[model samples]
Target chain A: MKIVLCVKQVPDTSDIKWTENNTIQREGLESIINPYDVYAFESALRLKNKYKNVNISALTMGPKQAEGMLRKLIAIGVDDAVLLSDKKFAGADTFATAKTIAAAIKSKLSDFDLIVCGQFAIDGDTAQTGPSIANFLDIPQVTYVKEVVGYEDGYLTVIRELDSGFEKVRVKLPALICVLQGEFEPVRARINGIIHSQQVEIPVYGIDDIGLSVEDAGLKGSPTYVNKAYRAPQKETECVFVESCEELAECIKKCGGICE
Target chain B: MSKGILVYSEITSDDYLHTVVFELANKAVELSKKMEDAPVMALVLTKPDLINEYKEAFQKSGFDKVFYVVDERFGTYRTDLFAKAAVQAVKQIDPEIMLVGATCQGRDLAPRISTALGTGLTADCTGLDILENGKFAATRPTFGGQLMATILCKKYPQMASVRPKVFKPSEVDVTRDTVFIKMSVDLDDYVPQIEVLEFTKKLVCDLNDLDSAKIIVAGGKGMKNAEGFALLKKLADKLGGCVGASRVAVEMGLAPQAVQIGQTGKTVSPKLYIACGISGALQHTIGMNSAEKIIAINTDKNAPIFDICDYGIVGDAFEIIPKLLEL
Candidate 1:
């Protein structure tokens, strides 16, 4: 069985600082593999470790700089890595994103049986890509997944997380599953694995390579656009001081606030 | 002619409408009154037998029209199928505005319907109002919960997904009545690519259910470590309350995500909310601002949490919590 894990290289949101021009200062801030995608990568690695016949492949779309993330995934135990890098793929939203990814998967149609991705990208938090990709592929999608029960001949049992609770779901082979963050802890990198990944060659695919027109890959294909981005005004509130134990008790009593 | 506002009524596991459904109903009525005697319409996907159980609740909550799709396949939420049915219904009924709760199901269904109808959708709105020209002005937090922005859709049947607990539900009117409209759809034509095989509930800690708790004791980054959280638990247990946390506390791994109270987390409205060692960022305060009474305990007297708090303690939470636990 061959598993394809969709990963992304995103700006570390925690470290993002704004410049005077209201744009993100990507300078000095390091880029890493999206945290949620790590869970998907770990899940794929676990499957490979359990089954000797299983092979895991890493796939991502971003600038050429994203090749570093793919290399890191290869270091962590993936067998092959592919980068969908091109200026035409810039500014694509979830819909266009799913299209490009589906096209990439189709190019390797013979060997792939399952596809996995993180539940959502932290930067967007839209949680639309996985389902949209499933729709494009015309396959069943299980989202907010916590664990995989087991895989049979052509069906896989899995557990999905709902707002109130969870339910057991089963989807056939050739399906998409989005794993939630912290679903499973990642494996520690070994010395041999790191050396092997450094020596491995990663293939890059552009617009023509994927058989997609430049118009269908990027800003032109995206339906939703961020018209403008600005910071929200902050609301002001007054702070009060409570000095002594007596003052604290009096404040609690006068305010009728929480206390035993 | 007065225009009617529609709400997509979502169902809970207990076979009742989710609380947000009635909240939206109350909001719809408010919006409808602005349109000269318009009525609020509720669209439910359920069986005929189930409709009877929810009809009175809808009427009591201010629904003037109860439009329903009664079918077995409608029991579970399927986005494409529901969107197809809802789009068809809206085209026939012709509502001026549509409101949906920003729950997981709503987040999935609203966009699909909006896209299919070629309308605009404003998601996770914190505020809503009718402009002078009678357009829906929706306000929502953006940029990782740092700012609030108001937006207007250029298209008709303006749709918005309201965050739950942002609005209050109206008092039930037992004397009220409603008009029930039963609608049917062919489920065989729509096939869902995603199938729900099974669901497993995560194990929630005993201290996590703070929303329903009468007393809620929450700690923040100021609590410092696990020992501080343990102290908070003792106080919560003594006060017969549950423990809650700020986003900082959750990020620090001192508490679980379920107990997080903030803009991105659960919005809680308990009777009494105790903030221990919390500085009270605006995002956290928005979630707990509706609580009946608030008591803030932090070492920094100038911490922002004191402003919204009904009571303030400028002492260390490490000292206050332990003393309170003994009492």
Candidate 2:
């Protein structure tokens, strides 16, 4: 079985600071693997353990520096790593990003049996990249997948968490699944694994290497454009500060009035 | 010319029209009015008889036309089939803007349709509007909800998905002479890729269902223990609402994951959200900010929750929540 797990490096948004221009201060920002992707990697490792001849590759699209993140994936037990990076890929919306990734998968990891992606990325939070990539690859996709239950007879059984409940589904091979964060501690990379990762070469694919035109790989390829970014308007209620619980009750009665 | 704003109507697992349909319909009416009162429309794909069950809702929600494709395959939502039908519907209607409620199904289905149509889709938008030049504008939180960006789609039939509760439905219905158009879809060579084994409803549905709750009383790290959450539950019960918890509170075992609200948790925009003992991290605030009214009670006046809340009370939840219950 061959699996390609898509991963992303996201800044720790909790520790993020904003620039005066309302953009994120990316310099000196601490970046880590997307939490959900960590779960996806864990899922792949579990499958590797369950079945013989199971190979896993970690794929990501970002800046060239993301190779460092890819090496970390290799260190954490991914048999191979692929980085799709280029300045031409900057400011790409979900469409363009998925386009780049689907192209990379076709050119680099052709005949892959499965694609796994984190349900959402912290920076973008779009949750569209995985499904769009599936569409670009012309494969079926299942989103909000909680975990892979097992594999049998070329079909993979998985659980999908919906708003109201959970659905257990069995998808055929060559499908994509977007994984949700699960309750498991991620495995740490051992010393020998880290050393081997440093010694191995990880190929980086730019837009040209992937046979994509410059105009069709990034912002130019994206149909959506950010018109403006600003702080969400703060609610201006004058925040009548009440000192005691009794005063709070009185305030709600007068204004909040919804309380009986 | 692309002349209408189309919204998707979903029949939920509970076998009823998801309330978010009406919410999006009302918002579409507002956006359409700004676009020279362009027609507001909807698309529903459900079991054959389900369209009749939802006709009154479409009529009362101010839709000028409701295009529906009834098929047995729609009994269970398979992305390929739904997207195929939706793509065909959009190609025929040629609406200028397409809006879908950012529910679990909508989030999963909208992007597929957009990708198939080769158009831009802004996901989980908190704001939607029309620019002066008649382009669709969508605003959503990016970077873990730390910043907000308003976007525009250059392609035709611009698309976006807004979460439930972000917009309130109009109190008064604008009943329209709705045209129910029964459309047909060609599903040739489209096969189901996944087989359904079972669907198990989580027994804790009531607590997790914050989507339709009109009011929510939430606690945070300041709500020290289960006892603190018990008080919140009492207040929630008194107010005829549900109880919610911040991530820290959930981690502390003060509440279950089912009731957690934050960037990672469910996005809730109830009529009234009473945040008790929450310090208002950007993560927690982003989920609840859409509430029509917010009242924050915390010991520290400097807690950021007070900044975005409609009212601030510098008191302990242990003391204040009980008083609110007394009222």
Candidate 3:
């Protein structure tokens, strides 16, 4: 089985800080492989363990600095890594990002059986990239996937988390699954693995290498534009609470006014 | 010439329309009223048998016209088939604005349809307004909900997928003369790639539907363990409300994903919200900040949750929760 997992390197959102201009301060914040993408990598590794002759390639689209993230994936046990980085691919939205990735998958690693991605990147929070990539690749996709049960005859059974309940879906081979952080625990990199990763040559794909026009690959191709970004105003209040539950219940009636 | 605003009537399999459909419809009606009272149309996709079952309800949904695709294959929610039908409808109607409920299915379908139509789509929007030029100004929380970004689409049929409960649904009336246009879609050409095997409902302790709950008792990472949420559930039961949790608690396995309130989870606006052990990150606060009243219980005095709450108690939830339960 051949698989390609799309990964992203994002600033650790929990430790993020904003500047006076409302721009993210990306300097001090440590950039790691998007936390959600690790679960996708883990899923592919599990499949590699289950099947014979399985190859997993981790791919990411970002700046030249993102090669460090690809190496991290290789260290964590990906068979190979590719960094789709170029100045032309900068400021791409989900649609343009998906377009570039689809082109990379076609040109670099064709005939892959599956594509796995994290449910959503914590930075963008769009959750649209995986589905858009699946659409660009003309493959079926299931998001919010909680579990990858197993592979059977020409189909993969997976559990999807929905709003009301869980649905067990069986998508044919050559499909994509957007994984969620569930039962799978991410594996750590070993000493030898880290050494081998640094030694592996990561190929960088530019827009010309991927056969994309300059106008179609980046900000120019994005249809939606961010007009403005502003801090959410803080709510004002004079908050009070009680020591005991009985007193708390009374406070709810007295202070809250609705807790009769 | 710019056409009127359009809505996708989101109906569940149980022959019920989702509350979000009406919420968007009401919002669309208001938007249209601002745009010289341009028609607010609804595109309803359902089985033939289910059309009459929901026709009058759709008529009262404040839409001036309803474009319905009634085919047997349309009975189930499949991305490829629905997107194709919807794209065809959008081409025929040429709506200036399209509103879809940001449910699981809508999130999947809207992007596919918008991409197919070569248009822009704003996802998971919390606010929608008409700009001076009549373009739909979609406002959504970005950067983990620390800031709100208002986006504008360069292409036509400016589309947005709005979260449920962002706006309240209007009351339904029986006498409204909402026009229904029956449409046909051929599904033979589009083959669905994914097959549904089985659907199982998860059994949790609370039957509370967080979307409409009047009172919500929510916990956070400070809840420590699953046992902490059990205490929240008890307090919620006493208040005749539901138990909600921050994304951290859901990620910590202290609560189910269904109960999580955050940028990635459900956006709720209850009458009274009692937050316990919640440090109130922007991601979690964005979902519940619309509540009419808020009360926070956290041991840390400087917890951000206190800044947003109407009333707050600086105490350990574990100690105070037990006392609140005695009543």
Candidate 4:
């Protein structure tokens, strides 16, 4: 079975800082694999460890620096890696990003059975790219997946997380699943895996290499554009400070806290 | 060009109209006014028996018209099935603007619909409005709530999935003759791509249900232990609300990860959010700052929580909460 893991490199949102003028200052922030994508990779690796002849390929679309992150995935457990690197792919919204990714998969990894992606990226946090990719490929997609319960006979059972609860569904291959971040322990890269990564050839695909025109690869392909960007307003509350809990409880009551 | 404003009225697993539908309806009314009173409409896909449940909501919420498609397979949500039906509805109606609630299910469905239509969709929008040129503008938080961007879509169906509760529902029911139109779509040739085997609803009144809670009492690393959380839980119970946690508190196991409220977790807009022992980082505060009222209790007088709270107490949550719970 062949699985493609769609991963992204994002700024570590936790380490992002703010300037004195209330603007985001990301100059010194480090870029790392999106935290949710790690969970997705873990899910894929679990299948490989449990089953036989399961190969996982890591794919990403970003600047050439993204090749480093893909190599890291190789050391962890990925069978191979593909970097869809091109200046034309930068700044594309989910629409264009999905087009570029689906194009690469069709042109390069066309025979793949499944694609797994993190439910969201910390930088975009759109949670749209995964499903959009599935749409562009004309395949089924399941989002907010918590677990891959079981897989047999070309079918995989997944537990999807909902706003209210969880639903387990059995979906066939040629599908895409976006997984939520779950509580997972770190998976260390084996020494042998590290040695192999050093010798492995990471293939790079450009806009033309993926059968995409420059117009269909980047901002030109994107339908949405940022009109204005600013700091979110901090609504002034004129917060009244109180010394005692009695006043706090009184205020809570006035705010309609208690209800039948 | 598109003519009307359309909202995807989602029916949840509980077999009821998701509250976000009414919330979107309320916002849609305003946007319609801005669009020279463009008609406000709704689209629903559900089983035949469950079809009528949303009518009163549509009427009272001031929806001008409703278009629905029913099939037995709609008993539960299947992305393949729903998206197919919704895409058909969009083609049939050809609305100028489409709004979807950014709940887990809506987020799962919106992109597929937008991509199928070859249009743009702005995700998790906190604000929606019309520009001077009449293009739809969606304002949303980007880079994990660190920066806000006003986005514009240059395609048809100016689609956006709005964050729930950002716009409040109407206070009074509006009496409108909402026209109901039943649209026909044949799925006999359609085959199910996925089979739902089991479902487990989260426990009712779960402390993690911050989205619908009227009030929430959340804690942070200052909530040092189970004992601190126990105090928070007590206050939450006293207020008939729920308990939420900062990512640090969840990491420390003071609260379950399900209840973690931050940039990476659930965004809530409860009526009152009592932030105890929390120093409001932008990541944490952005999730709850939309609450109508917020009160914070911490030992540090200059905690950032005070910057966004409606009330502040520069003292211990331990001492303050116990007394508040006693009331």
DockQ of each: 0.26, 0.61, 0.61, 0.67
* Model 4: residues with Cα > 4 Å off, grouped in runs: A17-26, A241-260, B205-208, B224-228, B248-258, B299-301, B314-327
Predictions in order: lDDT: 0.74, 0.85, 0.83, 0.87
Estimate, for each residue in B75-174, the C-alpha lDDT of model 4 and write its tens digit: 7888999998899888889999999998888999999999999899998888889887888999988776778999998888989998776788999877
In terms of TM-score, the best-performing candidate is 3
Model 3 ranges with Cα > 4 A deviation = A241-244, A254-260, B171-176, B203-205
The TM-score of chain B in candidate 3 is: 0.95
Task: Tell me how large the interface RMSD of candidate 4 is.
Answer: 2.3
Q: What's the TM for model 1?
A: 0.81
The interface root mean square deviation of candidate 2 comes to 2.9
In candidate 4, position B212 carries an lDDT of 78
- Each prediction's RMSD to truth: 4.4, 2.8, 2.1, 2.4
Candidate 3 collision pairs: A239-B311, A240-B312, A245-B323, A245-B324
Tens digits of per-residue lDDT for model 2, A96-157: 99999999999999889989998888778888999999999988898888778999888999
- Candidate 1 chain A lDDT trough over 10 residues, lowest sum: A231-240
- In candidate 3 the C-alpha lDDT for residue B175 amounts to 36
lDDT of 3 by residue, B1-327 (tens): 347998988887555888898889888887887799999888989888888887777778787888898888776677667777888878888888999898888887887777777677888888889889877799988778877889998888888988899888886552358888987666668877788888876554545589878889999988899789899887887788899999888888888777889888889998889999999888888899999888889999899888888777788889888877765
